[model samples]
Target: MFDFVPTRSDGDALREYAELFRASFPDAGHLNETYLKWLYSENPSGKVVGFDAYAEGRLAAHYVTVPADVFIQGVRQRGLLSLNTATHPDFQGKGLFTELARRTYERGAELGFNFVYGVANANSTPGFIRKLGFQLVRPLDAKISLGHVAKVDWPAVCRTAAFRRQWTEAHLAWRARNPQNAIRFASNRDGVLTAFASTDKPGVVVAGEFSPDGPVTALPCASVPILPRLFIGLLPEASRRRGLAIDVPKALRPSPLNLIYLSLDQKQKTLPADQIALSFLDFDAY
Candidate 1:
């Protein structure tokens, strides 16, 4: 049997979260105390909401939802970004994953959040759909551009898009402090693009490009990818084919990323996949 405790943002809790994270995921070493503090505690939107399972006083499994404000149907609403989930090897077959999510979502709804969403990889898609009642919206497009990638009119795109993550200056500042790597931001007379070193490969991932203040910030970059790598977000539904970018085939990608959503209010319909615009910056892609 396991006891599920609500996750908290405190000195002891932060340490435990980081400890559990490193124990649960092989590549979670970078998510130490400092990183967890910034992620789970310092979000400008809201605090992290989730549960930690303890078995005989040992932290065995955990799941957390990062709070975010998103535009659903062009209307801004409070939402939860379904993120970090981990279970120690010994705790695997006890239904902790779904139960943790269930309780977390329950708590999220209690906190008055409108929806919960995330980018789910191929392996986790079925579990989310068949088990967790989430809709597998669409497979995110992956494109690689050795040079400049074309920019779309974001205001125009937002008008047609079914969903978009709300980005404020505060949110942008919090994201830039990520301990994982440095995000290089480039601006242009048209828009702004942010790229960071990809942990998976030897290049940078274009986080996302934005048209903010209702206008362009600085001059456009000579080339998009400063390191000449890839951009793993929406390329077709939201962007166009220009510059040196080519769509990466499914077979070539190490793993396929799919956007998934579950509305806290059952009355709200699942947002359409086709109109959703995403990028690494939108979620925990780093």
Candidate 2:
């Protein structure tokens, strides 16, 4: 029988975790050890949690949870964001992932989290939906705008006392929390600052307020008809080479967004018939 434990700040334990991740997803490319170290480090004010499963004396599976505050129906709610779940290929079908995930969910609930989120790919979504009984929320709305200048005028925007204070705090917080992720900031000639946060796969431009006092609003550019096409156009050649497919929200399709299909829980009261489909991104595992 294997034992599951929360990974404390042990260097050896973390190295084992990284090795397991690489072995589990050999095609995902390099994930630097330094990056994983920073990710597992704890902050009193931050919202990241790490766990590991051990079989005999070796690490078998690992996962991380990121605490996010999401707005649902104009109310700010706490969300548990699951990421980087992996198990050694040698341990496949041994139920390590399922065991680890259930324990993680219980721990998250104990920590006062209301929802669990994850983005699953084609191989794992069905099991998450069928076996775990996780309800599918609405497909995340993602839009992209191209011809975007890669540069920004940070100095000019920093001139404003309010903008400078908020920008500095947000930037630092983001960096400290997401050491493995890339965050870019820029400003235009009009002194309007824009911030973007992305992983190697998908990118999101931070536009509106995401705080308790702030109201959630989609980006103005998100409404542009060409945004979807622009996003599809921007996929990295490497991702396309590997057969990465973009999953678009159903409501956004056919109008300007050109989304393909959407995933929703059939048991959910609000789901529309014929509009629901299997999600490429699993909400429970994100």
TM agreement with the true structure for every prediction: 0.89, 0.58
Candidate 2 lDDT tens digits, 46-65: 44665778889888888777
**How many clashes in each candidate?**
4, 9
Error of 1 at 184 (Å): 2.6
Name the regions of candidate 1 deviating beyond 4 angstroms. Answer: 203-207, 213-225, 235-243
Residues forming the 10-long window of minimal summed lDDT in candidate 2: 277-286
What is the per-residue lDDT of model 1 for residues 1-286, given as tens digits with 9 covering 90 to 100? 8998998889998888788877777686887888888889899998899998999999888899999988777788899998888888888888999999999999999999999988888898889999999988888878776665555766676676677777666676677778776455666555555545455665555546754423323322234445655666663355443666778877888888888899998756697766776778778787
lDDT of 2: 0.45
